[model samples]
Target: MWYRISSSTVIWVANREIPINSTSGVLKLTTSGTLNIFRNTSDLTPIWSSNASFSVQNPVAELRENGNFVIREENDDNPVSFFWQSFDHPTDTLFSGMKLGKNFVTGQEWYLSCWKNSDDPAQGEYTYRLDPTGYPHNVIMKGQNLTFQTGAWNGVRFSGRPKSSGNTMYTHKVVINKEEVYYMFEQINSSVSRLMINQSGKGQRWTWLQQAQKWSILYEVPSDNCDNYNICGAYGDCNINNGPVCGCLEKFVPIDVDAWTKGDWGSGCTRKKPLDCQKGDGFRKYSHIKEPDTLSTWIDERINLKECKKSCLRNCSCMAYASLNISKGETGCLQWFGDLKDIREVSEGGADLFIRVAFSDSDREKNKATFIISLSVVGGVCLLGLPLAFCIWKIIKKKSKLKRSKGILQGSPKGILRGSSKEHSNMSQKEDPDLPYFSLTTLLHATNNFANSNKIGQGGFGPVFKGILEDGQQVAVKCLSETSTQGTNEFMNEVKFIAKLQHRNLVRLLGYCTDEENKMLIYEYMPNKSLDWHIFNEFRNKLLDWPKRFHIIDGIARGLLYLHQDSRLRIVHRDLKASNILLDVKMDAKISDFGTARSFRENETTASTNQLAGTFGYMPPEYALDGILSVKSDVFSFGVLALETVCGKRNREFIHSDHLQHLSGHAWRLHREGRTLELVHQNISQESDYALEMIRTIHIALLCVQQSREERPDMATVVLMLGSNGELPMPSQPGFFTEGNIVGSDADDNTLLEGR
Candidate 1:
């Protein structure tokens, strides 16, 4: 029985099939060393017994502190000396230090079985156990049917549950060897926790809360609807965040399109181009996701990832392969055969799976061959001495076409900025001399027709894809979404604004694409993705040290400075948040996404609009409420971003244990108490050299986020404060510090406010 002292919780039962209805019962150990429980007053029949094979000289039945009832020799103190234990045959709950797996030598299996119902203690339909088939992994079965899996162990934790390794209450571990394969968890402190497969077949982690004096659920497997086995069917990936949870992999299409459209993804998907094993096949890498189910799979502990790919390629039956050990640098090989099943996209700490696909001709290689032929033709042209006048005319014609294409977006009234065509032309000629216009066909070839695998991120505008151009240059393609509320206005606005403004801290827009219905903007890709991916993430935040965080803050400030003061136009970035701030290869930050931005003449200071557009947590009080937009609006957002960078928390999502205030309010409270240093994240060391700089940065950020627009410093002044160690004024109260003050309380990022 599990310990509660008041009422013991029944953890396991040996004789679930037989019910002992009589009140008269006797539990005793006989001379044969068998522990038996008799139900009748006559003690004629024993209901249950621990049938020991051998008799001990001095037998003892002792209940260990971990709730493992054992039978062993009285003289033996070692745990190995025990002949039988309750932990070996767990019914529904698994306590700390209990092994959940198999012993090959004895052919004994340890598994958890759910109760028939809340009231009854009989064996239920669901059984949770280690499936040691291809690779050892935990799975739940509904009788004989495999219903759910915890994914294979990936050196740290289960591959499916990416956040499992971050739990502080217990340390989860798996042991795999020739003799046995098991999974267990050990308590980190005095906290009591248990794992149980309940009547509903959900595996839940229950922890005893001392303050509440009750057991509360800490975590659960099959947590989301996506965790159900094969929920997306074969060759499909489940993403709970998306509108339609089930989607096919790249180079694949739904087998039954009509059924799939009606939300019936059970038919799954099939390859668009059938694999030709005779010609050979290649693998397409899908990252940041749970590897497919490993039921029909093989594992080679000795082989590396390269060898695994080669091995899968040689065998036409092998559909996918993944590295077994993700914590370490690519160790062991795992190959899956037949249809790949039960794959899902995880937010963090996920392994990469390479799915086999037909080896198609690459456009880059073709472009290289064409380049060589063009070089040969140019040599012939030089030798022939073409007419100078004809060459000039050809160059002028090309220039005219380029200008015509540039003006194609100007026809949309909503998209055009407050400038004449001559003004735009002059700006384009002066700044963007190398802006190339990519054809729809070229982009289609580059991004595999907007494959899901190529998609890097999704915004209010549309999905952004990573593509490699013909010259092997990688670019980020932002294609306008058909369903997006933001129409041609925002898309053309970004193209026009960024094309004329060039800076090291700004994300460079390479070109634009217009193919009838399709409109896209091509940009230089940032490999590190966005700042939020690192600064706000539990695992990734550790990679950003105080110095790297400071560097990002500095870079963002400089980018803002360019927009506000140094640029050709006095531009105000209406939408500036952590996600819009992208990080490059060296982790240097570059400001992006200028969809809602507006430009002002030298005399203009502020503008008003009936329509409001910006993220919730970052929006300034005046702009969000009254629709008054100015350079200070972005300054307020910068302050929030700076604070988030230092604290490693989201402004809106942050919760303090001591108070009900949001992140900014908590920081303000700490600053008032002269405990500002406590606001830093645990990852940042207090004794680091940049500790003072961090506090100073927080102080500056506070000044920027002041409630009064006049109190907040401009972007130019904010940049100076970041770089210099100077005296700073006390910050006034920050706007929307309390939950009550937040507009449209339920509003999230990219929220719209209807103006009064």
Candidate 2:
């Protein structure tokens, strides 16, 4: 039996089906180099054996640190090439270094079979393994039934599993070659992880948590209704966020509409117009979607997308085509023939797929619009025979009416508001087409006329109130206070910048209200409140163990990365502190407060302003002193936030009896003395298993808070560093390191500045 030493939990059993039924069982190696387990010393028949192919001079049975029981020659210096390893036949739990694929050359496959139950070590009905049929992908099986699939490997990550990429805890990848094909993950740090399939046929990734002293579920497969393999059938797109969870692609209609309405989407969909491939069908592009299954696909790594399109057009049977590797500048082609299946909409990191369609269906909408406009113009000219001067005057009058309706302000035509006049009422909606508008009466009813009891939190821009709309949707209403330090410019700036952004980690903007003197912004309600509410409170801080703290740190880093590089606009969040980070029901972090944020053009890297606006301790030295701002400014703020999170104290208000220095300076001092684990909060310091991870986080924070901004890593590199175990460089002393003296020069409010 192979068991965990700490818990004595048996993960694998060699003789699960046949019990030895004796307490005097002995395991011994024979001269033939076979490892055998006998019922007793007097018994000659062996019950189990390593069964080595041939005899060896001296065979040694050893268990490796990564939980691999191996047999090797005694004097052999090679560590990897063992004669036999228990990893080759994993029973249930797959450790970090184990492979879950097959070797075609040796005809040996590695896979996982779950235990029969919690008490039984026998193999269960479920199996999880890599399938190499068409394009390699992970699949889950229950007996003979295909329960779920992880989609195909799309270079960066699995097509169906977008969250698997850029993970902070571990790095996962799939390797394909003539000799072998396998999927494996390696730990980024000292954390222990196991990927296992339970008896219920559910695949889950569990990480050992030191503070909790138990295994915490990092992720699970079949996580949603959409994860069911072929849930939507052929040519159907599954979007979990949608009402029905299944919908047909554009220009396609359900084959059985009544069945679909009844929630039986198994019949899938069919094209409205029949495809005439011989007549040269064109392809319609679909973005932000999981590419179709690659079962009947052809891949060419040498061709570009343009050439891939040409090649697909030449083949009558080709149904869809996409870039083989999304990360490598579209250098390869992945074309699917026949009907598309198992396609879903992924909110983030989804690939673009182009499906072949009839030429009439391809440009049907565009051609119809053009034909309607042309017919209208001809009909007007023939029917009325109007004079040129009269026609021009009518067009000018219509243009004037549109301009007035747009409510362009006197000085700011881009719709930046001054006062709450009727003209400025519809300005936000007109400027940001994606942003919805909320009526003043609706907000009044939601917040019960801004009652004091309804207020949740207060900020520089305004006070936040918890509200429930008429539709029973919970919302956070950020009502601008009469004595607010931030002006209308900052309010409009937040609307303009955050309206176009969509990210899981960023707070979502639901709608805005601009009713006379009352201005407010509505957001999805965050139940757990902000990070400061939990991390700073004496009683609440205990809920944030080491694992939860690390999770928050990773979430904040990813959110900042999205703002810096992944979003459509390059944004610099000047105010990123503990209070600005909100927690959801699951304790996932969502960044808020975009009032002091600034955006840059594609090629623009840095900007300077006479106004320095942000919290005092969170701002970098250059940004606070010289009014210089960039993405690095946010990185510096994140560093401070990370430190405060780890230590469970505010940087600006930190009071240590041993030193008068701020939190950054104190952390640096402890790090220099090789006592970095001391920086962990006392509430969570007893988690000795996470000491190394906490030290690494502190080291990363120090690197971000270094004196020179040039030395700071970009968000992408920072994310990589956080998720990797490679050696990091030595960090210098943090900026603004002072003893008992805090710098507050040429400033307005120390807490926040209406920088916009």
Candidate 3:
């Protein structure tokens, strides 16, 4: 019969027909290796039996650390041939080293079922098991109905669980081998803790306190109502900060407004404008967002952040994506193809989500029209009284001519070449008679009639061609483009400004030929071509290692330092960039293409203009927005070029999330997060110890590009910072936060606001 250990506690006996009803009822193993129970003085009964499957002479049962009771064969030391084991028939508690999924091949299902109650040990309604359906994920069930889930396991953690830190009490591991899949955890130090699936279908951890001889609650899964099954319904983010604690994304609105207002948000939300692939649809990046569920349809584990966007954009079905594993250099990509469900805005450390939007050309045209109208208004206000200004300009021109003629008369040469006679006659009347003039025919023949193959490169001024004179001297001939937007006045301005300047870093103007349609400037031919060709080209980028790259960066800085401070005229190369840096055969960098160059008096700091012109990405925010040009304009462009050199990527083509439009802003974010190393190009050698120094250079480049002209560092200080080993000042936040477009503003007001 069954024995009642206490009047309130009941214990079961396998062979209950025979009862041992004495105080000396002892169940003991005899020397014959047989276990028997003796009740009274002469009464004996067989309470239990063991038929050890092993042929070994001896066997014994022991409780393992995993809490499994197994009888092992002494000689074979094999527990597989156990006569009896608690694992094959489990009790109420499923401890650390337990298996909980089905053994499909063996037809043996291992699961954790809750007890009827604390006082009863019968099976309960709730059960937990690992589901191997579309993907392997954990599921809890109550009476065959899905109750809770632990989401799919990413490489690092469960997808549903928020990333956790500062939990050092235990180490956890989830293993899936050929035989079974299980969840387990080990204590960091010797502490008594147990995890249990309670009677009410809740999972919890409890730790024992030896002094109090009691158990203390540690943690519980499925912590809140949002954690309940689809509580906010689909495509709805749960936020504890909000009143109702649930809402749709920016471009989305509630599908059932009445239900949502009544606090019944189960129907969730829908898109305001349905995505149409035919239109110019694009993704809007949502940062610090908990990615949605139901990702099995669109997840790709191999692409990078850029590639992930491309993959999503290419396939119209993909709605969003987040990093599957964000810890170790973004190992995997998780994308959502259709509907996004259970999204949340976390306080910190969440992935970015891109949502699709309708694309319409009319919207673009309207934006362009608005920009032109605004520019026209600003330009008109700045250029009022134009005819009166022209009269003043003519009077100045007359006085300038008189002074030039006086200088020409004082410096006329004795000899003039034969072909240059009548043209030379015109030169004698000109103001600057000592100005060297080369014949158009001579320059044309010297440059092989400006052959296409001989053309080295082109700038705003024109195409530069390689040539060899009769004396076997190599030179580059820059022929002004006939169809160029720049006029003769701008060309003459450059010739006049750069002709008198002489520096090793500046491209020397050998001579100029202006006869009829042929206008060309000749200079010493640089064999290595422009710096952009080598530094930015994918195949050639590797040639510039850290040492060579740093050397180039330093050389360019020095050249700029000379232009801004050391030179007699405080000149600014408004278009300073990699394309403007010409490299000699030895790769010595020389600044070229001074078409957009400007000069200032010694005491002057900046100049204002209504015209806005420069390459798109290289233009500083202040100069691009408000037509205020200054030395800082050149500084901003240099910053972009410097970053491009380090990463071997173009600023315009850099692909961060939709929130971050350019490389400078992306680099700034990573730098502030103390993860600037992630910005280094993958091809850069890791063995080098200059990574930190490279980051410093990148920081300085960012400082130079600060949106406010006043915020940018001066050239003198930039040169010193680059050359010195001293500690650098912290840089301010860069331009372009996660807001609307920052374009279409004027330079003066923009610079002033940014400085404030």
Report how far off residue 736 is in candidate 3 (Å): 3.9
- When sorted by TM-score, best at the front, the candidate numbers are 2, 1, 3
Runs off by more than 4 Å, candidate 2: 1-10, 19-25, 39-43, 163-166, 363-756
How big is the positional error of residue 698 in model 1, measured in Å on the Cα after superposition?
44
Name the regions of candidate 1 deviating beyond 4 angstroms. 5-8, 19-23, 361-756
Checking candidate 2 for backbone clashes, the offending pairs are none
Clashes of 2: 0
Backbone clash pairs for candidate 3 read 1-16, 280-359, 625-745, 626-746, 626-747
lDDT preference between candidates 2 and 3, better one: 2
Question: Per-residue lDDT tens digits of candidate 1, residues 390-425?
Answer: 796799888756644553232221221122244434
TM-score of 2: 0.55
Compare candidates 1 and 2 on TM-score and give the better one.
Answer: 2
Residue 669 lDDT, candidate 3, scale 0-100: 81
What does the lDDT read for residue 430 in candidate 3? 74
**What are the per-model numbers of colliding residue pairs?**
0, 0, 5
